[model samples]
Each structure stands twice: as structure tokens, then as C-alpha cells.
Target: MFKRIFNNQQPISLKWKWGILLFVTLTLFGFFSSLIYQQNALNIQLNQIQANHQYFFEAAINYLESMDEPIQRTHFQSVLDEANNNDLNNTHDSTLEFLTYFESNDIVYRFFNEKQQLVYETQHINLNPVEYSDSLKRMDVNNQMALVGSTKIISENTGESVGSFQYIVMPQLFDDIKSQMQNNLYVILIGIILFALAISFLLIRLFLRPLTYLVNSLDLVEAESLSQLRVRKPRSTDEWSDLSDHINRLLDKIDNYVKHQKQFVEDVSHELRTPVAIVEGHLTMLNRWGKEDPEILEESISASLQEITRMKGLVQEMLDLMRADHVDIDYKDEITEVYSTIRQVFNNFVMLYPEFQFYLDIESDPDELYVKVFRNHFEQIFIILLDNAVKYSTDRKEIHVALSTSVTAIRVAVQDFGEGMSVEDKDRVFGRFYRVDKARSRDKGGNGLGLSIAQQLVKSYRGEIWADSVLHHGSIFYVEFPILSDTRQIYKSKQIAKHKSL
Candidate 1:
């Protein structure tokens, strides 16, 4: 039954959790405070009672010592009566002064002879004999708690033993005060606790208002409204305000992502439609009448094959683009030697295009430059740049490759004497499926994804890649990667240790 009431599936709210926490804290504080207050008040009352008992016991002793030998009950009774009648006279008589205390207070005074026989007692309450002590001893008198004090008196002149002096104080007044204090304390504490709980809840709601507003705004956000959706910023300079700023930035990214996704879909469809239409047209013409004529049939088959091959290349490039975006995840720990990879790719390009003038300049050592990049990805970046350089060359079929090293980075620049682009084209050259001259790009079999893939790979390795081009002049592509020292030995040792552990 308890489990059903507090079901885990329907968990508690944050506000209630805060309230419960505050309640427990306040309750514990009040409990400890009450205990401390009660103890302190009791100690104070006990001390006051002991001081009064001592004062009265001493006074009674002094009065009894002034009397002659063989004291009688009449002595105490007569002296007490006189002390009561002259209590307001301000007389200095010891008997009167000592006995005057019995007027307004309830105290049992008893005097015993040297033989331990009781001589005089003010109250008839039965209190047991207490041992001589400066502090009061506790005992029961007439079904009520009382403090008892006793002492054997001695003569100051002859040093002879006098009768024993004893006093029993009920302390019912202290008990009454304590009971009243306890009741009052309980009432005040309960009232304060209730008022504190109310204030705590109000403060909790005030502090959490921003969170509630954010949640409400988020609840209204859907896919269709993402482009226009933005969470309002909080006014306070606290974590809530920072959270609001972060959430707003996230929404902005989501909006851009959605827009980019829509654009990419449209671009892919437009690129695929042309080749599909060409192939479909060729097949349709062949099916209708071109099948009977070998010339028409061969022409249609050739055109169809070309369009299919182009479509296949387009599909492969699209796959490569997708893979490039996630290279960091698949090859996070890869390390590649920069000098070797660049030289290898540059040599391969040099051989592939013998007609073009390819110059390779190495300003760094043969194998000193290393960077945090997969060898394959490092090679691909240069391949794209070199290929573009060769394909776009106009009057001057020359390409210069330079490798340089700095204290922090390894830099590679590929310069092509090609018919370059305008300022606008250079700025957007790395965008997916973006071409400055679409007709020329298609003729060169460029799907416009090569530079985009290069950029993605470079960014994945925390490197930078960019191009500088002048209209009708030439273009230079630069790639820079942070330098790594002694990475080869470290990587080798990690591999050895990993295999041993396995």
C-alpha cells in the first residue's frame, strides 16, 4: 500500500523535493535548539535553588548558635512569629532575619539536638536525613520533589557540637516556571516552523520560475516551428541566465541544421535527376525504334552507359562526403607522418600527369613532420587539391607544391596556374555541391564535392585548409596541421601494451 502511494514510476516533483528538504532541515534545527534551551534553563534553575538554600541554611545556623544550651521547639516558634511580625521593620535580629524567609516560601526547616533528636520543624513533611554537603540533595517530600540540605552546627567560642540544621525546599515554583516555559517554547517553535515553511516554498518557486518558463517554451517547439522558435533569455545574472543563453545558441544551430538538410536534399535530387533522365531517355528511344538500327542502338547504349557511369561516380562521391564528416569518430587516435604522405601523393600526381609541369619543394626534413591524422585521410586531402590543380590549368600547365614546418605546425601549399575564380566563388568554393562555373565543372567531371570533403577531413584533425584565388590569374590552396613530436614511438608502445593486455 505504501509503495502504491509513492510509486517510482510517478516520481516526485522538484518543488516538493525542495520543500521536504527544507522541512527536514528546519525540524532538526528546532529539535536541537529545544533540547539545548531546556538543559540550560534547568541548569540555571538548579543553580539559583542551591544558592538560595545555602543562604537560608547559613542564616538559620547563626540564629540557633546565639541561643543558650538545650534548645526547645518554643524557641523556633517564638522567633519565627516575631520575625513574621517585624519582617517589614528592617530589624537586624538574626532570629528574625533568618525566620523571615519562611513567610512567602515553602521550606521545611528542622533542627535536631546533639543526640540526633528532632527539636523543631516548621513543616510536617516527611524528608529523610541528608548527608552534610554545600550542594543540595534531592528527595521526595509529600509526593513532590524537594531539595534537602543539612549540616552539623558547631559553637564558635567553645568549639562544642550544636544541634544539626536541615532544610527541605520543594522547588515546586521552579517546576511551574519550567512547565510554562516548555509550553511557550513549543508554541513559538511551531508557529515559526509553519511560517518558515511557507516562506521557503515561496522562495523556491521564485528561484525556479525561470526553469518553468523555459520548459513551457520548449513544450511548444515542434519541427515545423524550429526555424522561428527561440527560448526567451532570463533577466537574472546567474546560472539560469547562462543556461538560457546556451539553449538559445542550441536552437540557432538546430535551425541552421534544418535549413542545410533541406538544401542538401534539393541539391542531391537535382544532381541525380539529370543522369536518370538521360538514361531513361536513351532506353526509351532504343525501345521505340533505335533497336532495329545498329548505329542508333550503339549510340543509345553508349550514351546510357556514360550516364550510368556518371551517376555511379556521383553516388560514390556522396558516400565519401558522408564518411568525411565522421572521420574523427572512426580514426580518433590515428597519427600520420606529414612529409612522407605529401611526398608520396605529390609523386603519384607527378607521374599521372606528365604533360603538366609539377614542381615539388621541400623546406622541411624527409620524415621529421608528423601530425595527428590518418595516413589515408592525409593523402586524400592532397589528392583532391592536386587533381583540381591539374584539371583547371589553362595557359600555364604548372603546379608548385611547397612543404614547410613551423614551431607549432606543418604547412603545405599547393599553387596552380589555373583560370581561378572571383572573390565570391573563392569564399564559397568549399560548400558542398557548389561550383563557380557549373558548365565547366560538369565538363571536367567535377561533382563539386572534392574541396568540401578535403575541408571536412582537415577540420576533423583540428587542422585548417583554405584557398586563395585571383580572377583569371591563379589559385593557391594551403593546409596546416599542428606538429607532433615523438608521436611514432608513443603510438607503437600503446599498440604493444594494448595487444599484451588483450
Candidate 2:
């Protein structure tokens, strides 16, 4: 119920809330502590006054005892009556004279008899009779705070209580000290509250300044102004710096993706335009003269058919590229034997290009070597690589397919002794619709999406693919897949053996 009330309260900024919470907590703690200290100090002062009053009272009583005169009730009463009536003319009593000396020093003495009746009091002060208790008491006398000390007076010879003596004195100096302390406490409290607020504001601003800058920078970013979105680097290597670094990295990825998307659209349009224009031109020629001329008709029909086939292949490759983006979700848990898949692709390619010399190398056991990839997708990857190798092989007409295993992964390399590629071509060979030899690629019915599709598929399977090429010494495309555990290899071998036996 309390939590609901708190949640429904008016919203506050985090900075102000935290600052105010800290200030309030400290202020409360300090206020209570100051109150306790002040109370303790006052108590100590009161105790000191009590102790001093008791000592002085004891000294006066001892002086009276040393006078060697017996204290008579009747005579003491007569002296009190004389003092109360302001008649000091005939007073020759030694105890009364001694008691009067204290009156001169600001101490008021009140005497009570065994019957609890006040017998005598100082003539200078008029004090009301108070209840006699075992302990000393504080009283308001003559409009001043005073401490009253009481003690029973007994005869030394008989050890019998006769009367009681009371002494009262106002603690003016201690009162002044307490008043000053209270004023100081109020001043300190006000200073502390003001300090807390100022420091909190400064600290919040100092800490949140970087965040404000970062937000402002983000606000400045737009579709056409992504390059302007640059957050200022923080001065320290703290969480703010880490946040800035992460944001910069995210921006970099977004920028690259946007640029790649734009380039992809442009490349696709450029690639399809040639084939489309060729087909349109051929159709126009056939409609004009090729209907009557059989040679022209045959030529135009063949040209149109070739362009159509190229367009169909380009469309299919584009679809494959799109599918590769989401292939991981489609085949997340699929697994395949790396050796068998490579062997199947190798055999097919060799038969498909009988004139080309194909060399195959397997450095791991074919039955034990496995990777995390769908079987068909795995075969498709190698087919693309092998196809490229065969198509690029020049007069040497030689290609090599090597499969090797490491402690962590399975490595496959497809090498072709072809016209090869320059460093620039090798770098961009896997880019969408990018061809090293554009005219040659067009003549050979290649739309240049093969390697790009292969790379994306390899990425989906958590694999790496890159090419190493020499200008005249051909190129080798390397693909690496993380190897499945030994347990998977054993299980697959058992399953394969069982299937074969059946």
C-alpha cells in the first residue's frame, strides 16, 4: 500500500531526487546528533553545578559544626523570625553570622526542622517551601533557574537528625553556554543544507554533461546526415567512455550497412539493364525483319534466349543471397559431415568438367570429420566455389580441392590455376555483382553473384571465407568451419554404418 502511494507521487528527475535524498538523510542524521549532543552538554553542565553546590553546602555545614556552639531550635527560630522581619540589630549568633556570609556570595540558604517545616531562610531572597525528597531538585526561584541541594543536619554526639539544610544557586553561566551552543547549531544546520544543495547540483551536472552531449549528437542525426552523428569522446576511461565507444561502433555498422544497401540496388539495376536492353533490341529486330528472314529470325531468337537464361540465373542468385541472410534461423541446429559433402561436390564437378584436372586432398578421416551445417547448404557452398574454380582455370585447366582439420575447425581451400586476379579484384571478388573481368564475365554468362552468395552462406554457418590471388598465378578461396565435437563424429559414424549394413 505504501509502495503504491510512492509510485503515484509526482515524478521527479533522477538527479534532483538522488541529491535531495542524500541531503535529507545527512540533514536528519546531523540534526538528531546535534540535539543529542546539546542535551548531553546541558546535562553535564547541570551535573557540574550540582556537584559544586553540594561541595559549598558541605563546607558551610562543617564550618557551623566547628563553632563549638550547640544549635538550639528555639534560638534558631527566634533568629529566623528576626531575619524575616528585617531586624538584624540584636543578632550575635555565630551560626547565623556564618550562614549570612553565604548570602553575600549569591547562595540562598533555607533551613527546615525535623517536622518538615521551614524554620529559617535568607532575608535577601523570598523562596517558597518545597517538598523535601531524597535527591536534589531544580526550581524556579525569583524568576531565575536555580539548583536546590538538600541534606539532613544531625547532632554529632547523639547521631540524631535535627533539621535539614537547603542551598539554592542559579546556573547563569551554563545557561549562557547552552544558548550559544543552540545558536551555533542552527547556523551549522543552515550552512550544511545550503552546501548539500550546491554540491549536489554541481556533481549531477558534472556527471551528466557527457550524456547530454551524447543525446544531442544523436538528435542531430538524420537519414541524410548520418556522417554528422559523432559523439564527443569522454575524457576518462570510465563507463561513459565505454558507452561512447559502443555507440560509435554501432554507428559505423549502420553506416556500412546503409552504404552497402544503396550500392546493392545500383549494382542490381546496372547488371539487369544490359540483358534487358539486349532482349528488347533482339525482339525489336525480330519483329521488324526477322519474321521474313529465317537467318535473322534464328539469330534474334537465340540472342533473346541467351539473355533470358542469364536474367533467370541472376534472379535465382539474387534470391539465394536473400535466403542466406536468414539461413541461420532456418538451419540453426542442422549438422553435416564435412568430408562427405566435399567429396560429393568434388565428384560432381569432376564429371561435369571432364577435361579439367581436379585434385582432391583430405587430411582428416572422412567418417569422423563433421561440422554444424545443413547437408544441402553445405554442398551448395562447395559447388559455388568449385564452379568458380573450374570457370576461371585458364590453359592449365587445373583445380585443387583441399580439406584439412585443426583442433578447432575444418578448413577447405579451392584453388584454380586461372587467368587469376589482381589484388584489387581479389579484395572485391566476394562483393555483390562485382566481376574482376566484366566483359569476360558477361561473355561467359556470369552475373558475378556466385562468390557473394557463397560468402553469405558461409557466414550463416558461422564460417569464414576469403580469397588469396596472384595476378597471373590464379586464386585460392579458403573457407573454415568450426568442427563438431568427437562425440558427434562417433554417433554419425555409427548411424552411417548401420544404414549401410541395412
Quote each prediction's TM-score.
0.86, 0.73
Cα lDDT for residue 231, model 2?
72
Error of 2 at 94 (Å): 8.1
| Candidate 2 ranges beyond 4 A from true positions | 1-110, 120-149, 154-162, 166-187, 223-225, 282-309, 322-335, 366-377, 457-462, 484-502
Q: Could you report the Cα RMSD, in angstroms, for every candidate shown?
A: 4.0, 6.7
Give the local distance difference test score of model 2. 0.79
The lDDT values for all models are 0.80, 0.79
Quality of model 1 by C-alpha lDDT? 0.80
The all-Cα superposition gives candidate 1 an RMSD in Å to the true structure of 4.0
Tens-place lDDT per residue, model 2, 367-402, is 556677878788988898888887777889999989
Candidate 1 Cα outliers beyond 4 Å, as residue runs: 1-5, 63-65, 76-97, 104-106, 137-146, 155-162, 223-246, 486-489, 492-502
Residues 314-403 of candidate 1 have per-residue lDDT tens digits of 888888877887888887767777777887998898789889888989875753556878788899999999998987899899999998
Residue pairs with backbone atoms closer than 3 Å in model 2 (clashes): none
